[model samples]
Target: MSGSLRHGSGPRSLSEIARSGGPTGSGSFVYDEATLRSLISKWVALADHYDGSMRRINLGAVEPPGLDFASEALSKSANTSGTAYLKYLEQNYRYCVEQAQLLQDTLDDYLGVEHQNVTELNKTDQPTGSQSGI
Candidate 1:
């Protein structure tokens, strides 16, 4: 049989390669415990900056320092091939932190929209009986 006619022994398509969960591909990149810890720490710090009382008083001053520290640590640790993994971890960690912030912002916007809708509904001069019926 021709090579292309093979059942499972032939090379995979791009989509198959992309979707595969084996080694020698993106699947090989696993998030280690240290990376998870760094990600969680960054996310908590970001949430604190956005919602903590001290952050509110300071107007978001705390987040930059934490981000800067993370950047510096990543740069310092990215020297050897073993430590080179830190660079990827750092990038992923920052991306996760940013995603968390975006999610929080989206939720806040949704809540504001809902609150406004409720306020508008309440402010209408409709009959209490009709409104209560709904």
Candidate 2:
């Protein structure tokens, strides 16, 4: 087939390669129980920073560091791109957490875009050459 994604029996594109999964790819995360436990424990205890930031924001003692100086009305009105890191982190709470579930979710999200790109490329210039592998 002119635009065939599968070349013989092997992964024919980056999308396929990623979907295949491996030790570092997706499902095949090969960490020992102790390592995974240590990581998860560290991840679970990550909220101390949140406590500090909340205290700072609550006190209104100072604008949380790195946030550009602007009045609330102006900052709100502008709808600026590139807000402070803390603010961005606060907004994306789900992504901020370190967990195995997020890995596949994130990969699937980007894989859609990659698949689209591969489709577009195939449409423009479908390879005639046969690829070889198992």
Candidate 3:
């Protein structure tokens, strides 16, 4: 665009929020609905991307020991290495997913909460009806 301030699609009901409609209107939070949606989209996509990537790593498939070797020491060594690698992969996978999920969940929750708060605020601020007839 140009060197001017641009606003997003914003809340459907603007009258309730634009009490001032000037610099520093309503409250601290200007409430940009579009920006919130964009952030949520990114967060969800990241979560999905991570989900796809992390599971694709087939770390659980360990190679069997050399059958031709036929030595107890070799078998024991293979078992130990296999267990260690498996455990490492499992722990790291869990940890990475947990962190990604935490971020995704937090963003999702904020989006829900902000949307709900705006909707409720709009409902409450709206003119109930004309009391003139009563």
Candidate 4:
């Protein structure tokens, strides 16, 4: 994908758009498909890394140094903190994966429209033979 694909920017020709092979926009912002895909890949990678890291962590395996009340309190606090931290990581992973999926869907749609436009243009540009068979 290339830059300069806009929704209501002043004016654009089909050839210019076809040459760019860029994004589809709604009103103001337009994203380049290639750039978008790269970002999406990063997001997915980040999410997967986070998920794998979280899976490797075993907060429950941690034990207190002593069997005293203070140790028990510390253990409970650690568990609470660990659970909260894991929750945060889970949310972050979900957000990253979700954003990647959304961007991927948008790119797919843009590609579909671009393909259709090219197909239509080719149909119109084709040379039709005359009925006279000359």
Candidate 1: lDDT of 7?
Answer: 57
lDDT of 2: 0.39
**Lowest lDDT 10-mer window, candidate 3?**
114-123
TM-score of structure candidate 2: 0.32
For model 2, which pairs clash? none
Q: Provide the overall lDDT of each model, using Cα atoms, as 2-decimal numbers.
A: 0.39, 0.39, 0.45, 0.60
Best by lDDT: 4
Question: What's the alpha carbon RMSD for model 2?
Answer: 18.4
lDDT, candidate 4, at 113: 45
Superposed on all Cα atoms, the candidates' RMSDs to the truth, in angstroms, are 17.9, 18.4, 16.3, 16.6
**Per-residue lDDT for 46-124 in model 4, tens only?**
7766777799897644578799999988888898888888888889988876666656555666576432232232235
Hey, what RMSD does candidate 4 come out at? 16.6
How high is each candidate's TM-score?
Answer: 0.26, 0.32, 0.36, 0.60
List runs of model 4 lying over 4 Å from the truth: 1-27, 113-134
Candidate 1 clashing pairs?
A: none
Better of 2 and 4 by TM-score: 4
